[model samples]
Target: MQGDVFQADEHGPAEQPGERLLLDLDGFEGPLDVLLALAREQKVDLAKLSILKLADQYLEFVARVRQHHLDLAAEYLVMAAWLAYLKSRLLLPEPEPEPGEQPTAAEMAEILAFRLRRLEAMQSAGTALMVRPQLGRHFFARGEPEGIVVVTRSLYDVQLFDLLKAYADHVVRTSVRTLHIEAPDLYSVEDALRRLERMLGRMPDWSVLSSYLPAILGDPLKMKSAIASTFIAALELAKQGRVQLRQDGGPYSPIYIKAGGVAA
Candidate 1:
């Protein structure tokens, strides 16, 4: 889970009453993951996830954790604090960032440097990949460069990924739903996968899995489901000694095929 939220009083026994049924916000990947789970749980408008209240509560919860647990969470706590800070700034009616503050030279230089590094790394990676017949491929022919475009934009073009910080902001202003109340299960992997296959007109590569899910489910969710369901089901069946997931097929990845399911 990502930037999720919960009041401190809500989590307890870590299992029996309020546990397992809902994800623990503290167990999230980031503030956004936590926010996404809350949005889905509350059925918040797909357009937004309350970020301010969530970020505030996140920091509060971090402070309240067992003294010992704080050490384990120091890094996460730091990030949570940052989210809360960023959220507060957004709530105020302000013109905008200071003129010079717009992508400071350091930030711009860093971004450019990062892009250059990526290009170089891509070249090196491409070369290394070509050493193995299974890995080599070029979407553009050798010595051909791809076109790049630059664009100016505002937040409306944002995808779910862009909302992590946004969610942290709204969470403070609007209450974040706690999983204290019961919510009926929505999509189980069992049903979700079936729906996905139907949506795609076929079972698809793990990468394509999320495209069939709700936008809130998002691309990252689909990628995760692909990796999880494929491996988990394969593992279960493998224990029964029936099938195994093999990744011998280039970029297509592994599948659980019966011991004799495929013949070379």
Candidate 2:
């Protein structure tokens, strides 16, 4: 039954010398064009034509074309194998479909039809493109010749050392600097200790350490240094058991000092 289906029709219409069909099977253009022509003869739409039904006719056409042009049968054979595979897929029973399965015969046929339609559209577009005028060969731009204009200018090739020297000179000219001389601190810790002793002898009772600071120091900056020196001297006298230091309130409270180590 399969052999009968694939067998060529011996009684089909014969071709005359003047009416021979022009086919370029070597170029592989004949297969698709022949199939389209056959579909048109059956009054069937190219997209809806059953690949299974046309399979036999297409194979027969390829076999006959092969007999006339042996050298050109390679592409035709490949196309035949593809159609034969499609035919077998349609005839054979398919397994139960799982997720992410291959496309069915109907889907494959639709895809083939879409591809054929796209191929036809691309071929038409290609033909239209070939027919249009080409640049530099057919069409040309119209413009006047703007002759070359050359204007020479001078250029200096200065060295990196020269650039550095210029930068240093510019910086020296633009920069402003003032000379500062800081005098040495003449007040000593011994001086601070003696001053504290004299102040305590005058008071001789519990007094805030801030009260020991002079009523008039020379300047605010000098007074800051003097206060620091006095505080250091008080710490030394406390260490020596010569003075008693106490804070009646919290840590941040004023420190009270007296002449003797024994608290009153």
Candidate 3:
């Protein structure tokens, strides 16, 4: 009875098995699934393909299937009912909406379309998962087989006296003998003073302290100790007024020395 109200076109081409089910109109010939997808994606003009016409075609399809004595699926009937309800809602005049009120007919249609698209996406994902290679069936994990391991440990039994004896022997073998040899004092302050006095007696004019050093000491190894002792001796002689010390340039310049009023 519902099919009679929304019947298919008698002049349309005959349906064939294993062929895509399409809604054949005067200017449009496409599957309803494709139309819904285009609508959801906003790729096609909804004004060109009317919703009322789509619902009519779907009902007509149901009618055609019934004519062939084929049992209709529950989902087909559900979709037909939904299409009819959507059509009625779209056709009727909408009332003014209040604040925080229910959605309008157009909004409800958009929500339904969104839900259908989500369902389609879930189905596509499920199909992809089903076709993917499963573990153990397609391929097995590669790994080396487990094996038993054997470990050998060595133990030594000894007495306290033997342990002490071994420790004493190790210490005796590794112990180092440190010899401290005392180096004799090769040069002294008194010797440096005696030498400087003898040199000053011969040279009456001012001369650099370095000139006096070569006459007093010669060994390179004793140079550091000799220089230190000579400087100390010079200071003592200066304090005693035996020699005069002066630097013409700056603090870092060579020390100029001459015999003072007191002869050393």
Candidate 4:
């Protein structure tokens, strides 16, 4: 079924042209991505670059992606709006600061810095996923019992960028209509995680996991920030060998957290 789907995609109207999805030494996801890529590729100052041409490219890129990938265009539109808004403002005449209010260069830098940070994160995940060998489990209908598979530390490491992307993707999921069940309040988990985040932490109990989240946020659009923020904090603790996530089996398994980090 999987092969058949791929074959259909290969020959189907949706088939991407050979040159499509291909990244040049610097061809980027969008104008912001392109600027960031160029900055990295050239190893030049991120500031002082002309935003005019880049802003135009940003608009053009959105239109191009829409023609090729409708789904991508929807998500890219958010970035497009941000660029267009910035471009429009930059085109306006400078206004005098009223009284003691001055917009510092640092503020402008931060506005542009977000794109650079996010692009780096996106690139790292793309590289990591590209290197991992494909597992054919989806190609088969069933799997025979096999020996335990062990993965060493070298195999895969998740990054904060990936966590943000995943959380964004998760938030974008459609909300469930069914009632949510949990023994504890979500604010409690948020408090716990936030507290644990400040000090290196441990794995959380698997059961009642929903308590860690706002039940109403089962939908995608609302879950991104909270979940993504939680995700990286957990992993940061794990990286220092200060925290470990433990899951007990069956109904007896107690899902609890522990601290792990250089300090732990």
TM-score of each: 0.26, 0.38, 0.33, 0.30
**What lDDT score belongs to each candidate, Candidate 1 first?**
0.48, 0.70, 0.67, 0.53
Candidate 4 lDDT tens digits, 1-264: 011111111122345445334322123444456557545654544455555555677677557545544444333467677667777767776676677875543355466766676677888999999777666743443467677989777665799999999888788785535797865323333554575566442334232322344444455644555455455555555565756655556765544446542322
Model 1 misplacement above 4 A: 1-27, 66-68, 95-98, 103-264
Ten contiguous residues minimizing lDDT sum, candidate 4: 1-10
Candidate with top lDDT is: 2
lDDT of 3 by residue, 90-206 (tens): 999988879998778788676655654665676589899999999899978768877869998989799999999999999998896888899965568888899888876776588
lDDT of 3 at 200: 66
TM-score winner, 2 or 4: 2
lDDT of 1 at 231: 49
Q: Rank the candidates by TM-score, best first.
A: 2, 3, 4, 1
Clashes of each: 26, 0, 0, 11
Candidate 3 local lDDT, residue 133: 94
Model 1 Cα lDDT, one tens digit per residue, 90-185: 565545458666553334334433543455466579889777655235343457787889897865777787789788888887876666776643
Candidate 3 steric clashes: 0
